[model samples]
Target: MLRIATCQMTSGPDIGANVQIAESLIRKAAREGANLALLPEMFTIMSNDPKDVLRLAEQYQDGPVQRIMSGLAKSLGIWIAAGTMPLKTDDPHRVTNTMLVYDAFGQEAARYDKIHLFSYEGQQERYDESELYVGGHKTVSFNLPLENGLDIRIGLAVCYDLRFPQLFRRQSGIDCFLLPAAFTTNTGKAHWEVLLRARAIENLSYVVSAAQAGRSSCGRAFWGHSCAV
Candidate 1:
């Protein structure tokens, strides 16, 4: 059996501090013999100001964050599902919520951008990702060679994408799915676990999810029951 673990993190607005937390968890997971590890969405930074993302977004290829993740994966000799990060896109002001996968050698294996955008309106809350994030155009997956000659195909998705079953259904041959999320306290209490379980049962695939838990510096709270099904 493959050992997999997901980290439930509480990321703030500081890039250095966040990366340090990520590194600590990665080390712990590696020591536990986890073959694959996952981090939560916005593991780097979460800001109330949309402008912060544009300021933090990096070009697709080279960046300090990318280098750190790649190097850490290589050092630990494990596959990493790096959750969602802000990636530069063609649009000048917007970025892509992307999942970057790295192999044991620190080589990037695949990248999946979150296709669905989130919109919510409540008495005290309002959010629309379309204002800051660009939507992805394709489904993403990668295959891992297991010890017994079994190649497991895994699909990638982000937080809001969990609400859309059709997107996961379209990716055939996936034996497992990875979702990294920052679910709000209100939504998580009502729908998070139910939706995650439904997706796994419907797809007949292993689902591993990492989430942001607790209150963030941005004044937002997340529900953090990070689990696998």
Candidate 2:
């Protein structure tokens, strides 16, 4: 049996501040005996400014952000499903929203770029990520090796990707789906719990989610209910 911890966070544009909070929560999870911990999407920084994405986007395997996460996993002796971070892409103008998973030994385990970029146009709130993020094409999954000698298969997905069932269906025999998200207050209120429940019911698999809730540093409201089932 795997003990998992999903963190509920309220992040802002300050990368340093966000990382510190995440580290504290992760350490707390490890202390509480969580074998695996997941963070919310855009945990690095939920910026209202698009330039922050470009200013901070690092190459997939390189950069200070990646180094810190690897160290946290190794030193803490825990598995970390790192929430999505901005990754530099071939396109100089845009970056790929990427997720990185690290093993207890501080080694890279798997990587997934968010395939579904959110595009929502509400009367009050409008977001078009396509302008800043390059969509990812492939699905990704990895197995967690346990001391019990049973490896658990876990699939990877970012926030908006949860809206598309086809993405989850693409991975077979997944014991759990790791989702990291920061849903806008309006949309999340209408469908967050409903969708999460539906996904769990449809897949017959556990759904673990980390969320960004409340008012962010950017002053944007989020639907901050992190859940696992």
lDDT of 2 by residue, 1-229 (tens): 7999998889888999998999999999999999899999999988878998799899878899899989999999999999989999889889988899999989999999999999888777789999999999999999998888999999999999989998888788999999999999998999898888888888989999999999986988999889986
Model 2: how far residue 208 lies from native, Å: 0.3
Q: Write the per-residue lDDT of candidate 1 for residues 85-192, one digit (tens) a residue.
A: 999988888999989989888999999898999999988989999999989989999988888998888899999999999999999878999999999999999999
The parts of candidate 2 lying over 4 Å away from their true place are none
lDDT of 1 at 34: 93
TM-score of 2: 0.98
Per-model TM-score versus the true fold: 0.98, 0.98
Local distance difference test scores for all models: 0.91, 0.91
Off by over 4 Å in 1: none
lDDT of 1 at 95: 94
